[model samples]
Structures are given as structure tokens and as C-alpha cells.
Target: MVSDRIRILFNRIAPVYDQLNTWLSLGQHRIWKQMAVKWSGATVGDSCLDVCCGSGDLALLLAEQVGLPGHVTGLDFATAQLAIAAQRAQARYPKPPLTWLEGDALALPFPDNHFDAITMGYGLRNVTDIPGSLKELYRVLKPSAKAAILDFHRPSNAQIRTLQQWYLEAIVVPAAKQFGLTEEYAYIAPSLDRFPTGTEQITLARQAGFATATHYPIAGGTMGVLVVMKG
Candidate 1:
């Protein structure tokens, strides 16, 4: 079933997304995003896209890489989030000009083999069809183009799972309560539960016809990055 619930939720939380991300991740989200963008291997003059670009952080970083000639696009289904992203781009002046598009990740708006590289941050868990979304990402990327996607991970170790649950219920919930988004913030735990593990993600990437797929677990397995290379 195609549901608008996630879109609605993002629209409702768009204003606080960046701030909360920083708080929740203890300012480490930026580094993770940096690593994901780096893993994409988006060099100078490369066309890149940041899928589910909540506030254009990753897209802005990508623009820095693509420099003068290259261009980057930020795509998201949530209009409110896109508005915020556009505002950020305007205020920060992310060079190379950014194109913010309101669209679905499972159905990208670009032509096949168009983008040289892609990056996504904290988005894979929310999509309804993970495999379909991955397929679309693989489709739009040019041959040999790379993608790096960063998202929350469900720790396979029991102790780590306990830590994750505690952090979400204690730190995350309390922080989001200030914005009256307790219920919305609570979705993270369940989303992690549904998210594929690092190993499984690589297999899914292979199934999507990518020539290479690898998952790098980071932050003690609480976070992971799925890196892929198009054949």
C-alpha cells in the first residue's frame, strides 16, 4: 500500500529535522553524512543527487564536491521539507546551484543513467519498498556511478539493542516531546526493526544488479552506510 503517512510526518517535522538530527546524533550525523558523500566518490564536475534531502545538508555537501561545473539535485516527497531545504540553500549559498525537487524516492524523476553519483541520509528506513527504492536509485545512476546511503541500524548484538532502545525511549523521546512530536519520534525504533541489516543490505544491492555492494557499520553498529557501484 502506498501511504502518505511518512510524507505527512516529515512535513510536520521538517522544521525541527536538522536540529533534532544534530541533537540525537550528538553532532556526529554531519560526519556520517560526510563519509557517505565521500563513499559516493563524487568528484569535481560530477552530477549528483541527494535523495530524501530533508534540509539539503547532504546536497549542500555534494555541491561542494561537484564544484563549478557539476550540479546536484535534492529530491524529497515532502513539500515542507523541500521548502526548508530551499531556504537553507538560499541562506548558505551552496555553490554550483542546487535543484530541489519534490518527488518520490521509489520513483525518481531523472532519466536512467543520468546521475554520476548519489547519496541519501536517514531515508532508506522510511520508504515503503526498500528494494524498489534501491532499484530506482540504481537505475538513475550512470554506469559505474556510486551511491552511499547512511541510515540507522538495528544492532545485532543484544547489548547494543538495549542501548539503542534506551537512547530512543529516554533521550530521543524526551527531546522530541519539547516539539510535541513524541509519537512521530517514536517511529525510529520500529523503523530500525524493519530495516535490513548491513549484510542483508549488500545482498539486496546485488539483487538490484549493482556490480558491487558493501555495508560499513559505524558508530558501534548503531549506524551503517551502504555503498554500491553500478555495473
Candidate 2:
């Protein structure tokens, strides 16, 4: 039910998703996404997966990183978002080595050890089952491969945590109000409250079979990237 709600929310905001992201993050999401891709160790000719690849931002970056002989798959549950991603890819390349699919993150439609690298941007928090999603990610990644998951976090510092809450209520929600997405955007605060902390995420990743896992805090702990390597 949570996944269904999130899917509906994403689909409703698909038209203004890119614009809102740029505004909300002050255009820094691009940099964060790139960081995630780099941490994944994706290289030229290495197949990659970008889960919850909203609007194909990470997937497009992965495509550039793994060019020519390499391939990238962008998977998300929202059809509207995937449609926009496909259109963007078509406009950007004559034949981009990218595939867009409408699929669930908990049950990836891929074989074990299929991808050289994987990246997930702002997706882990919304999954109905975090461990299941991580296990699925581990199952699909090649042995010795890595996955970098980027997401917003509740700052451990009291002051910064208050600031984050204020920003979401005052800035983010109001901005979404302009697009009639106030309700959808308001869920972010509650979701962040329920999301696992970086330390907890590392533990979850290891439990899911990753041999090595590290959570790198970013933006003063307001965000983080969990890098996990499959053994």
C-alpha cells in the first residue's frame, strides 16, 4: 500500500518532477547523483543499473560513464516518470545505450550477478521493504561489483535536523503547492522520519549479503550515500 501510494504520488508529479527537484535541491541533486554513480565504480563498457531512476538523471549519467559497448538500465515503478525519461533519452542521443523500464525495486526483473555496477537515488527510503530491496540489488549485481544508494537523511545534529524540517515545511511544501502537489510533497518529512540512519543502513546492507558496506554522510548529514560491494 505504501508503494502504491508512492507510485501515485510520483505519477502525479511527473510533469513538474524535474523542475521541482532542481528548485528543491538548488540544482545540487545533479552533483549528488554523479557522486553516487562514481562511488558505484561504474566505468566504460561496464553494464549498470539505476534503480528508481526518476527522469533518468542517474541513468543518463551512468550511460555517459559506460559508453559505447556499455549499457544502462533505468527502472522505476511510475510509468509517467519512465515515459519522461525515455523521451529525454531519445532527444539527447541518436541511440543512447539506455533502457527504461517500469518495474518495482523490490523485485527487479534481472538475473543474479547481471550488472557491473548499480546506483539508486532517493529511493531506499520509500521502499516498502528496505532489506528486500537491498537483497534484490545484491542479487543482480556481479560479484565484486558495487552499488551506491543516495538519499536524503535526517541530520543527526539537532540544529540541522530542525532546519531540515523547517525547510521542508516552509520551502518545499510551499513550492509544491504552486504545482498543486502540496500533499504529495508533504509526505517527504514523514518519510524521512521513518527512514533508516546511515549506520542502520550499513548494517542492513551487510545483512543483505554485501561483503563491505559504508555510509558516507553528505551535506552535513542531511543526506548520505550507502556504498555496498558484493562478495
C-alpha-based local distance difference test score of model 1: 0.92
lDDT of each: 0.92, 0.94
Residue 31, candidate 2: alpha-carbon lDDT: 91
For candidate 1, write residues 21-71 as lDDT tens digits: 898888999999999999999999989999999889999999998896899
Query: For each candidate, what TM-score against the reference?
Result: 0.97, 0.98
As a whole number from 0 to 100, the lDDT of residue 61 in candidate 1 is: 93
User: Model 1 off-target regions past 4 Å?
Assistant: none
How far is 173's C-alpha from truth in model 1 (Å)? 1.1
Steric collisions counted per model: 0, 0
